[model samples]
Target: MSSGTAAGRSRSRSRWRAGLGRLAAGTALLTAVALLPWLSGNDPALTVLRARSADQDPSPEQLASVREQLGLDEGPFTHLVHWLGGLPQGDAGTSWVSGEAVLPQVTSAFAVSVTLMLGALVVTVAVAALVSARTLYLGSRRRLHRATGAVGVAVLAALPKFLLASLLATVCGVWLGWFPSSGWEGPASMVLPALALGVPSGAMIGGLLDQSLPAAFNEPWARTWYAYGFAPHHVARHALRRTMAGVLPQLLPTVVALVGGAVAVEKIFNIPGLGRLALDAAIAQDLPTLQTATLALILLGTVAGLLIQVLRRALLGPALRDGALPALHAPAAFRGRSTRWAAVACALALLTLVTAGLLRDPLHVDTAARLVPPSAAHPLGTDALGRDLLARLGHGALRTIGVAVAVTAVCTLTGLLLGMAPQVGAGLTEVMSTMPAVLAGLLTTAVTGPSASGAALAVCLVGWTPYAAQAAALLEQERASGHMLASLSFGAGPGHLLRHHLLPAVLPPVLRNALLRLPTTVLVLASLGFLGLGEQPPTAEWGRLLSENQPYAELAPWTVLCPAGALVLLSVLALSGTDAAAVRSRASVPVRMSRRSRRRGVQGHARPAGSYK
Candidate 1:
């Protein structure tokens, strides 16, 4: 017993050492990377500010002196050393715009951001994990699982964080007058932001559960506990407690990723987290602020990632470590002898697309249209544009789905290559992950001038990075486990390596990403469309659908509700596929045959005699 604690402690220390090494390495890399912008000192932040300041007609001599003082005249390397050394010394350099001490202003602003993220994470993760854990337990009632899962998917699908935050502020802060809106003074100040952040984050938390729970459901020790007449909760305990083995290792990176993340949520909620800080800097093209914020986010995220790795190693020890759990590989519904259900799912998806493309109603709404309302010639109603609202929304649903599928495909491809490839540079993944997706969307919109293609392009660009990171880590597992070498020794060249070995290894995770991300893409499209970044007011995109119907919401609520429902439904459907895939994924992990005797192994499978009862 003493030895076990000692062994666990020893392993814990080993993991800590490893994590610290990664932290140091990651920090050094980030320092070098951040120096690129810091070297320029005044950065884009100062450049833009300087230009604006110049508009006030500062003399050329004054301008030159300003630049020199800001270290803009220094070479990149010199600036790097200054910024790097200065960071630990509480001197992050001066703000280009205000000519204020960058460190103080930045720190003051950043305190709010940190508080908000912590609050949001607590609310989101705690609630989401509990709900998802309930659904994941094999002993969980089927009805409970269904209810928990349905609510989870629906919530995630139906609302973007910004819109949701706005709604909460409108209702709770305004109408109900429960919480204050936009002030940073009291407990109520955090409510709106936390709620706003929590809603979507809960969905993401659910996603983590989506990964963790299914695996726990199928663990053998869990089954043994059940057979031993233990309660379902006890079995779940065994499954999940031990499950850090296979799933936790995979989950750590994502958990880390949640650190310094969720920009839109932060922006909408008025939280002072890194996301909001990055956002404010990015919009103004405040180069110094942007560089500092981004580097800080990356640094924090990297450090979180290292911590998760240590936790996973400590938690998952011998039975499940190094991605060694045996995976149950099942053929897709297409390979079954009947293949009927998979076929149906595909057929339904295709049919939805076809009906969407044609702008036809899926719900037989036209026939039911006159049963409820009356308007100009079209009883179901003309929208703000007087176009057939139902038809337009239906078509928009298709478009939304189409965009989602495209984005998911891109994410999947990126994730697979990165996760399945060993020796691939991690720098690219780091660089991409820190990019603010909303900012990217805003930029794309700013450049392309409001079209579906532009919005789609924006989402595709930002969404791919996270997936790529996930895939890269997964690939790291294969390489660390020597699977790459095994393939190489088996005469698998690069081409064969990818086609047979890598692709297969990465597909399940790719599928998971596809499921999780597709819904997000849909929400993003609708949000952008609502903001008029892509598609015009007349077009029936989901965002536009809601926008057009907002005026009529009081009288003809269904006009808006129906499309929102459809958006939510499609999002849920995509998420459901992900959930189901997770279920199948969970069933694949075999429990260790550790009882150590042949007699016990056979005894494990015996079923109780029911007789005629």
Candidate 2:
């Protein structure tokens, strides 16, 4: 009876702890949302003020009345209470600019975002899953599993949303004339955006395949099929059930990226989805709308992450699910990292194929020779600006590799610093980790007006925080376990700790994780460029090029396609490269050890490399 009571007490404590964590998260979220009215109205960040703009602005009396109405005059703590009181009742207050109720717009836009998001999921999953099934079972004509995997992965993995959207809009809306170029018209308008949104996500499908394929390839059952003399097709079909063994956990991370991509894609296509509305409101500094949108997206992303967790448990079983989250697992578990070397070789070969196809043109005009159509002169043809598709593609290799490597170096290094900084001060680390990195980004953009410096600054600051938080969390745990004492016993000081112990411990995962983020940063940079925030004209940023040429997307499909294709190629390399690395790692794990034992424990798993995984 006493033991039972102790167990009950422990469970109660556990429940209370969980509730506290939830409360803290809820408070953080609410505080952010509650401040929307005040922040949007009072902060200079919210509005566009031209040169000669008197800072005096609105009259005192009018400003007072406005504050009274908006409840901005109240202290933040008091206002927070008021906002919290209204949240339960769903009274989000009025939009600062429109003077209309905020709830309705939030609801409408949220519905649109969710609907489009769901539709995109359906399409992407269906296509990606089928593709996976085909590669696993139906077998491509070449039977080059790795090559077919690379091709499919390339198209699915590397493409950027805006680039893909622009290309699809051109091909379907221009050449085929099946879809509209811009503006939300109806259900049909959702189709193209959804397709564009779905395309890059097919990479996630490839990732899922990466996790599943190798497992299915080597499973005991697959061996059994071989013993039974089962046909290759039959074996693949039977192997699928087992392949899903590791695919579920990857779905969460994939969906996070997917949802984020969908946000950008919806914005580019002028889809009236929540993502676009949020982005529009953000750019316009429509505080209520923007806040509401951010809140909603956070909710959606959180729920998706949660749902992925639940479904992962259901599908992949508890062992795999536990291995995936809270304690993020190995890159190999997620992407098949070990096989990435082979994937790299395959990727290089395909790149060679792409290059060879271009150089063999019949025109033989150094520049123009590379410009010919899918004819004897140039296989892919000339772009709208009359540049060789192949030459631009080759040159784009620089931009593609350059943007990705630079962003990764800049952002990842920033993230590593942030993540590792907590080793010095836990309290400070926690505070910095929780600071509004995202808010800082918006502030920088609003103030500086989106130059490369501004974009780089925003990304570097925001992107680094999560990584920093992870690093801090890991080090804290290690410290708690007396690992720090052991290091100190080894004559390690701060410098030694950072370089010999922490850096060695944190660098591998952080370095690899940094690689995966390059694609996202490049995409984000492109999106900003499309919005006219990045470098100026003729610099030839892929996104900037897209925006510059958006007007002619109809007349000159090739212009957008060239850059967009470049975007896709870059994305595929990052994602597939990451996954291939994971695959390679898995295959090379000591075969003597059971797979489960080699799987990193929860704490060990949650390294930087695992985020993308």
Candidate 3:
């Protein structure tokens, strides 16, 4: 068979496999949603009754009638079948809390969410394109500009979405009066939220494109086109397209993240989108609404994934068919000494806070000194309940940072293990990547009840997918490298190759990515807590502290600022540490290569060093 024809057939088979995998994942998700009522260990009818009237003591007959009305008395199989049957006809049942049709509510909210997502996506693409173009214009000679761009992008990406939302809402909305801070009034209100969501994500995409575009420009095809006397813009356009196609797969997870991150943004901005609806339902224990919302989100995510896949294929076209594209390499790191020192300072400050807080009592309430400003006794001030803000923040750090670290560790390990087998791991990663950590938290809260552990578990459930995807991609690149191919020619076994080559090659970069993700993990945990799906009040958690003190910001800004500031500092530390590590890793590569060359020379088989160049 011709190579092109064989490649076409291979793509066809891959599509079939992907279709099957998506179908299986959809079925599993639907089944889980259908069984959520039962999984929560709460009577759906009783829960509905409580939501309807929190003070009412319901009789057995009332509960039974409610169960019958909701069709929850039936087995899960029957419910699943009924739900599936209704989906084709747009029948998504009724909301237990609001007593409204679930379909209309979910659809309306989903439309709003889709609008927000589209707006954010537009911003994401625009920012990425602009940044990439600017970086290209600067070219390789402007190392300082490139370094500044990298740090700027990293900082933007590191900023928590919720924090950004708050800032934009305050400055742009409230202060400047450029936009409304709250409500889904119209397109005008969307500006701030879209910017909040898109800017960070844009920086992330821009960073990727900045790295990829330069590499793409250096490609043989790109050089050939340039040598053909093509217009610079025309050549640049083609390079951009090719670079996007190469990086498109990485954007799928970003889409998933955008959807998930919307939860906090919606809440902060008071946009009645699906994320807010799902969170509300989860909090209210409105199983019917929560289940329907969860399923809708899943479908939306699946469709988005499919769309991205189609776009990627379209962009690649002949290159994909001919298998001409090379596997992407990790971006080179730029050293920034200032960022390193800032990270160290942040870490020390945080450690000092945690150590000091641990030495004091967080829960000790003194009503006489309520809402006190920073004094000699209270370093950070006091909350409304007269609890020392410093004490709470210190103790909260342990809960927040400790949990984040643990989750990051688990995700990294899981990713490393799964990434060893790219075929299986990549598929699984794609499947899980569709479910955002927020949605996962909602589902987890439904099953396990709202707590710190549930929030952590929810994060762990989907968090590893990103790391796994990164590892799988790295593994693919390593496997396709000349060294690995040469080793295979020398009869290296799979075990030997995996132990000596793949693991060593993939581990460091993936670990650095995980370290970079630490702040994000903390953000996610805090988001869950902010939504009341994490640690409840009376417990010192950063998110819970924010949620509780938000209303009292004017009264005692310290209550809000302390935790928020801590989170911001932590984010800075994570970004700086990861970038520093990347620089160190990159710096060592040449030294290691030279040492290997020396060893080869000692073996009397090394070629002239000049030959390498």
Higher-scoring candidate on lDDT, 1 or 2: 1
- Deviating ranges (above 4 Å) for candidate 2: 1-80, 138-147, 170-186, 220-246, 253-264, 318-403, 406-440, 443-449, 457-520, 532-540, 568-613
Q: Write the per-residue lDDT of candidate 3 for residues 495-606, one digit (tens) a residue.
A: 8667556765677567666765676787788777776778787888877777677767656778788887787677667666656665565456545544654654431112
User: Candidate 3: deviation at residue 569, Å?
Assistant: 2.4
> Between the candidate structures 1 and 3, which one is better when assessed by TM-score?
3
Model 3 weakest lDDT span, ten residues long: 604-613
Against the true structure, candidate 1 reaches a TM-score of 0.69
Predictions ranked by TM-score, top down? 3, 1, 2
Runs in model 1 lying further than 4 Å from the true structure: 1-88, 137-154, 207-215, 219-221, 228-231, 242-263, 321-324, 328-392, 425-431, 441-458, 465-506, 525-540, 543-563, 579-613
* Tens digits of per-residue lDDT for model 2, 197-270: 77666655544454345444543444555665767766665445434433443344344444443555665676
Query: Residue pairs in steric clash, candidate 1?
Result: 44-287, 45-286, 45-287, 113-272, 113-273, 418-471, 418-472, 419-471, 419-472, 419-475
- Cα distance off (Å), candidate 2, residue 452: 3.1
Predicted candidate 1 versus true structure: per-residue lDDT over 311-351, tens digit per residue: 75555454334433333222222112222243355458546
The positional error of residue 294 in candidate 1, measured at the CA in angstroms, is 0.9
